[model samples]
Target: MGRQGLMAGYEDLVKKILRIRPELSEEDLERKVEEKLRSSPMLSRLGALLLLADELGALEVSDGSALPFDLSGFTKVSSLVSGLNDVSLSVRVIAVSPLVRLDGRAVLRMKVGDETGKASAVAWEQKAEELATVGLSPGMVITLLHAYTRSGPDGRPEIHLGKNSSVEVVEDTGTLPGVESFFVPISKVSTAGTFDVKGTLLMLSEPMPIQTKSGTVNVVEALLADEDGEAVLVAWRDKVDLLTGTLPGTELMLTDVRFRGGRFQTTVRTCVAKVARERHELSRLMAGSKRLVSDKLLRVLDVVKQPELVTLVVSDGVWVYRLPSRSMVGVEVKEGDAVRLVKGFVSERDGRKAIMTPEFGIKVVTGEDARKAPSVDRRRRLADISEEESDIIVEGVLQTKTPLGAVETRFGKAEKISFWLRDGEATVLCSAWRSKAREIDSMPVGKRVQLRWVRVRRNVFGELEVLVEKDTKVVVLEK
Candidate 1:
């Protein structure tokens, strides 16, 4: 049979079921109706709605003599007939807030409107992306079908496109005869307070890997701007790659962006980071590099107490430096001797300056990389020092030796030099910034050295400095 004929036949069957099954339960009647309509592809779209209407008394078979169906305490389904058949209707989209997930799924609320009326739509996960692409603005008219309704917190019926709903965008009519404009400014669009925005990328930063208590996570920061204003956009994990090869002048389109932490920042909830070639120019500047300072080399020992930061290579030409701890990780470095140190800005940590290794493409020459990058001393164990005054003995090969020089400090002038002490577990940054720099400048890398000191100070930045006075001995284990 033809499509129209098939639809008519299903309608007749539905009418018959309502008339003959007045005493049947809503479920039993729905089951029978589904069985009859199963063969009709047209009716399949209405299967759930038909069953729901019959259950809620929305569909009457007998001359409206009191709906045979009981709606009782069940959620009321809104009537779709008003706007469903309006050919003059145009697509209108409303902005929604970021969905907060207590469970595994995120739930976002959006409103779709036409000349007839407005209806709310809920999107989860993948569907959310579809609605986002439609560029749902506050004034765009939208057409949707197969939607279901449920009771909202206010006891009023709320409309939403079901999982199987089909949504469409409708263009506006020139005059929209007899239809009032329900269009609102995009500024007023939001789900709960969050809104959607599209903009251009003005600046971007390379992905920085952070080692958290849970695991390693990559994060990137970018500056996004639109006609309205500018804001910071943050992307997480694999999304960080979006800005990898992108330049500062690139244009970007963002959805489900939000205001966070007193500033407008986009998180990974429903936001998308796409490079817009038409809107902005690709940034030609190479990714920034982070520099590892000699002081930080020692702090890593006090914190992780391992070779975690020793001889780090900038694999992707980008890295991250966390504050306070002055920890450096995930850097791209090539293997070579006399590793070149790149220049970069340093941020203050605990009143001390900490350098970012990746910002200026700076790299530190690992003593191992210096001479075939010596094999990591796996047997060396991390030392724990706690007492204010204690004598301890340590043995390790000198990895690198710095030139001795007089460094002016608050406590008068003193010779300073830095050397890496490796005992198997990890390399420790030993600095004689006050008294050893001149003495150790003559010491070559790879020469085993022994030192005895009674007092030392560990700085807040995790760097270790030796406190030498009159009673300190430095013995050369091997020349």
Candidate 2:
């Protein structure tokens, strides 16, 4: 590489650095790079920029590469660099375009993604026919080997496959994330790109058939809205299935969709699935300034008895909610009871969102009226537990463990207990706070117990652990 080649590489490195540290202006980045090269006279400009990127924490694996899936020898879509050869990436097929003659050769274009980001890829000649033969569809995970990267028309890096390249279906991994997991909040979308979104269907238009070169295509338009904002979603061909039979207020998740010309459009690779509306709208209970009118039935998941305040871990079928109060609002509430919070003030405790009610805000619903409340299941398998979920119930045989005792926390020194809960499928570490530590201390070794309303969160070492607090209901069951 000559001076021009070296300068191009330097420019690319500068762009990569700017992408991660957008707060730094281009002139500032160039100035810093110049200063680094001057200090280390022997170091090349690119090497100096790499060191600078490391110093700024821009080159860390903190991006989507931190996902649980196997990323060995695979590059994240967001990390793709133009002018790199023999790149390997594991991504889910987002869309596949029909075979077309490009520059007198058959070409097949696709959109692929992992949890981190999405990218555009093109297959040429033999590879194009091979991909079409394989009938690649949306959601299929595959790895591209010996592919090359080039900047797209929009200046973003894209993958290209030639004669030496190969694509293999990833069959061994079950942890590959679905496209829906990357849903972008409605208010955050501001540019043209492929994105996933979860929102309630506010409006829908009748599908109309349009004649095209290939065949007749059905088109439908829908208005989607979430807590933050709303957007227009347009669907074409089979993607129109999302709009058919869908009613207003029904929550929908659109995956691998494209946003352009101030609207959203669904491609062949787009997947439309109806999301759980009850959970989607639960945020409204805690958000907004207006007082809630309709009584929201909350199923008591766990009850913690304290000296002054009783902490009730509850759920509205989807999201686990916290309620800490000195008074039960003239109602007798227990674990598994269905109650309503009237004019409750949503508050946050130790980073956890909770609701505080006054006078008569807490009311218990029973018998015939309870049937109308959302059904809440406190039972869950250890394997189903994830860091993103909370307020879980698990039944398993406990492994013997003594109380850790007197761990220092922000609050103060608190008694702590640890044990292993093992079911047929998996085993998980269960730890308890001071209020619940005594209960676990008395339990015999290998005893079967059901722990309800236990919180699921990561420990200090970044491992998922079951947290038992005063509200946790631990029932010793017969072995």
Candidate 3:
């Protein structure tokens, strides 16, 4: 080929790799292809270039005859690299993850690898159910005929099986080789894959309830560390129940854990977790751990989110206890719960108290009970709040709608609105998020508007002011 032809062919190969792994940096692509070319024999330099091009998808498969009969159009996982990104290839099933229901369809995603590299494969609808019918399991050699390829959101190479694809168990006839299994360190885990690793439990967060499309699920996080590094372990649903009795500093071997994007996590079902037999080292390490005194329980008066972290303002109503990151524990508690510092680190910055560790405990109590604790006085009439007091609750009727205004936000700007509220005694300006500003539209002017967990403080100019927090419940009572 001439110089121009060679340049065109090389550019086409680069474009092919970009199609499947678009996130692959240009420098990475150049290095991989150049290395592959160098490993080839010098006598087939020109031939190697042609093969690379055709393998990547530069040349379309010939129509009808002339091509190899039966297996003429098959491709390999390694060549699925570079050209046309998508290729019809056969691979062995390394591990099949448990079927998860999504939108009423049983979706099966699994780890499939070849001699080249590891990749993920997914099947949905009828293809998913056929996985069991074909008796697909760990170390099963399966031929995914007419399967296409795509780049996962995380840039990992993935094989996709659609309605056009078919899966059949192939005998170990030396043609298809089984992929080697290995353990991935916690540091190298970030995307979706089935992996195994062992580490010592450094920290354990309580089960946090989260709402999902399937329903509510409890998520608990455990930090595992060894001499190498630390990895995060998350257990979902009933899986968290398994770790409830497991204490910090225990040794755990997480096998076949489903690690999705964000952090190292583990799901139940197909995953197998084995804890260490003894924990003498763990017991000695926690000997000096700190514990919260029940007498110092701080009543949570309100909740506020500063950026991505939720700050719980706890008090006996006379003093404020600031717990900076209650979200880390994933605990759902509001004004009714009494937050107590537990077995974790605690510190005081300036004049305020701060719970440094994500670990803490909560005690549920009514507003009446909170008021009875020592000097706490949480509820008062709209006109009764004094300038010296803050973090109180009030109930009134929304009198007028405040004009919505825009405020600077992390992404860009956000809207906010305020209104006047009355309780037959006095009035205060109640604010709502711009997205929630229209909530008062359905609220009749005379319809009673009850505000719980509102903040009353003196603004910059030294005037008594009332502020509504994001968690502040604004319920419109009927006439």
Worst 10 residues of 1 by lDDT: 297-306
For candidate 3, give the lDDT of residue 461: 69
Q: For candidate 1, give the lDDT of residue 121.
A: 56
Models 1 onward score TM values of 0.34, 0.37, 0.42
* Candidates sorted by lDDT, best first: 2, 3, 1
- Report the C-alpha displacement of residue 204, candidate 3, in angstroms: 5.2
* Collision pairs in model 2: 304-470
Worst 10 residues of 3 by lDDT: 62-71
In candidate 2, position 7 carries an lDDT of 64
Error of 1 at 175 (Å): 8.5
RMSD of 3: 15.8
Global lDDT scores for all candidate models? 0.45, 0.70, 0.58
lDDT, candidate 2, 307-328, per-residue tens: 4446678777776777665565
lDDT of 1 by residue, 187-277 (tens): 2333434544554555544456555445787765655544444445566665565456665555554434565542344444333434346
